[model samples]
Target: MTPRYSLSQIVLHWAVAVLVPIQYWTGGSIERTHHAVHMGLSPDPWDVIQHQIHNYAGIAIGALMVARLTLRIFDRGVLRISARGPVDRLAQAMHFAFYAAVIAQAAMGFVASYFWFGIGSFHVLGSRVILGLLALHIAAAAWHTFVWRDETVDRMIIPRRTSS
Candidate 1:
């Protein structure tokens, strides 16, 4: 039988999925707030709220990544492919890269917020890298769903209980 992710894992995965986009959407607001602060002027009320959302959501994402990684390391029920192949290896690599990228981005955002060292451009570049990774990840899922006819998407979308 194919191993499937546990219900708790599925929930965490989706939670991060939801928050990632929120971070992207609020990315611009952070810049605006940063600009105002550096300019020695009060930030616009709406920009401040958006900036807060970005900060909190980013922190949440970082925390969630920690939880997700901890579960991944300790959980015995995570999906495991029985057969090893090139595609399988690629998929595994992509997942690892994504996990690392997200965690780093979150930490970077926090540190940058407090002590930005004119690295705003670097942050923007990192965000773009994340976007590219996300797009590839989604593409991979779609490929698994359609081309491979694998249940990869289904696994994350609808988890099933395993018998003890």
Candidate 2:
């Protein structure tokens, strides 16, 4: 049976998806509360804890992305969803955009970590760009899943069936 994604691909996809959100949540909380805490505006400990989570999660996500891309380039298990028509083609385009955006965002996060946040705070230009792209990506996925009633999202998340 042909798999929608090789075991490795599926694993990486889900892993990265799960990690990205954690990183985003932590990073965003830190960004919002950092200045306030420094200025004694808020005494919530959420900022410090979230910042650590963000930093660790970012590193893990970045590493996972590298592995995912490497597998994509080197292995044949990753398949772009097969398009049935113009609308499917459009969906495929959007999916491709999501993949590209994620990679770019991860790269930016890595660079930003080194350049801006000093590798500890997890502040990076990439995180901001990632937030915007993630918003767009999620919106597109929702539109495809609910509004368009397309299988694009399912094909990625669910295993595909094969004919004998």
Candidate 3:
């Protein structure tokens, strides 16, 4: 059995990890920094700038998601989590839901931007749902690390040894 994720997969995983928080920060920052924009009031220059940043970040994430999905399809080295019991099946389902939510959220944001010129309640709802999913993911990691005494998370991390 493969013990580790491919370097590309690891890199992409970390990339998304970094990008997601930035996405949320920028998404919310834009709103808080200038709520008037959403109220149809005169737009502030800074608001436009921040909104642009959020838009670009979302686009970049979307592009990265596509690349990640492509790599997932082609990379045969991906480590499979063997389904040992109910927990394993639940983990698999959670993984699928996470990926689907991410793709759908990105699509929703893009569509909202294209048609409404800004994000709305639907995009915010998606963000909240994704946040909940992320919490579950982290909890699962903790469970593997503490209760299961597994090296699952370690497999996704970069090796400490330089001589790999």
* Candidates by TM-score, descending order: 1, 3, 2
Candidate 2: tens digits of C-alpha lDDT, residues 1-164:
33476667767878988998787567667556667867978746877778677767777776777787787667755775568999768766765665665666665556555566454333355566567767877888898789989665675677555345
The candidate scoring highest on TM-score is: 1
Q: What is the TM-score of each candidate against the true structure?
A: 0.91, 0.63, 0.82
Instruction: Tell me how far the alpha carbon of residue 106 in candidate 1 is from the true structure, in angstroms, after superposition.
Output: 0.5
**Per-candidate clash tally:** 0, 0, 0
lDDT of 1 by residue, 1-164 (tens): 44578788799899999999998888899878878999999999999998889989999999998888887878777665444889888888888788898888888888887787466677778888899999999999888889989778887877768687
lDDT of 3 by residue, 1-164 (tens): 32777787788788889889988767865565456755878767766777788878877777777777777667666666688999889988887787778888888778877777355677888889999999999998998889988788897895323233
Instruction: State residue 86's C-alpha deviation in candidate 2, in Å.
Output: 7.1
RMSD of each: 1.8, 4.8, 3.3
Task: Write down the lDDT that model 1 would get.
Answer: 0.84
> So what's the TM-score on candidate 1?
0.91
Candidate 3: misplaced stretches above 4 Å?
Answer: 29-41, 117-119, 159-164
How far in Å is the alpha carbon of 72 misplaced in model 2? 2.2
In candidate 1 the C-alpha lDDT for residue 123 amounts to 72
lDDT of 3: 0.78
lDDT of 2 at 118: 53
How well does candidate 1 score on lDDT at residue 33? 82
Q: Give residue 113's lDDT in candidate 2 (0 to 100).
A: 51
